[model samples]
Target: MIHCMTSFAQSERSALCDTFLEVGPDAPTLSGSWRTRDLAAHLILRERRPDAAIGMFLAPLAGRTDKIQASLAQRPFEELVDTIRSGPPKWNPMALGSIDEAANLGEFFVHHEDVLRGVDPAARRQLDPAEQKALFGVLSRMGMLTLRSCRVGVVADSPGYGRRSLRSPKDEHGNVVMTGEPSEIVLYLFGRGEVADVELDGADHDVAAFRETNLGV
Candidate 1:
């Protein structure tokens, strides 16, 4: 059961590594101005260089993080992908199976989609039921933080998984309801809304306000 729960992260990592190779280093990705090379470097550093990884979430350290990432990006693209394929080094906490599952499952899933959608704007992947459920569980646990920037209440409505109140409606104008599969919702919440296949239903102004807000961590 433990292996079953953790396997998706490993699969996603493997698939993402394959994608990095297929797309080569110059391919574009949904992440800001980063290409495949930059994204690959970011992933490697995030796992191997804990000293610099904190900058990903800490604004004050972001400059240092950027510097390290840029340096890593200079390495051969195939080499970077190979490192990612090899998984975290033993010294990293993510080398532990459970830790990798918890930290990288959604990270790799979303990033894999980022590359796919970046290459082809119309790209979409059909996730298995277990994958959907696992992603939805992450949303249920982290939705509030991911959607906190929105001024109105946000609700995620995944048909089979049921609804999660991502954020309480901040005003009486009503909630901005997002309907999609768990995987799509994950992509949307993680700053890939432009390519995510989710549908939004809400008052026009509320929707506008929600759209204007920056989302995801």
Candidate 2:
């Protein structure tokens, strides 16, 4: 089971790598101003460049990360796409099976959606049961850290699969249940709630607060 999960995770990342090529460098992304090329540079730097990767969690290093990413952006568009398609280099720790699974499974899933859903009237991508389960499992492990800012407790439920608490929020009104496919729930938790096709059930204020808050990794 462990090996299979790792294999699937790597496959998903690899598939996204291929997709980056198909989307082209100029494709817009739901993620800020990043066109596909910029997104690719960010991904590559995150995995291979330890300094930049840590910058994501360490505010002080963010500028350094941005500078490096900008330099990468100056590279030819096709070169950027091909580097992303190639995945992280063998020497990168992200190439390790367990680390790769932990880091890139959700990263790829979210960024892949970033490209696919960047447009107006975006197309929805359907996940197979196994894919849904994979994302759910990852979320259960990391939800608390992701939603630490939320003021209301969050319970994510996917019928016929599983249910888990994203976190215990401080909202006195109590928790709210977000029901949807695991993929959708994960998307919502990752701050893409506006585009995630899920139902948020709670007090009007709580639901509204959830929507208004900026939730993401």
Candidate 2 lDDT, tens digit per residue, 154-215? Answer: 88999978988877778375778999998888778787887998998998988887777667
Name the top TM-score candidate: 1
Please provide TM-scores, in order, for all candidate models, with all chains considered together: 0.93, 0.91
Give me the runs in candidate 2 sitting further than 4 Å from their true place. 1-3
Off by over 4 Å in 1: 1-3, 171-173
| Native RMSD of candidate 1 (Å) | 1.8
In candidate 1, how many Å is residue 75 off?
Answer: 0.8
- Give, for candidate 1, the lowest lDDT window spanning 10 residues: 140-149
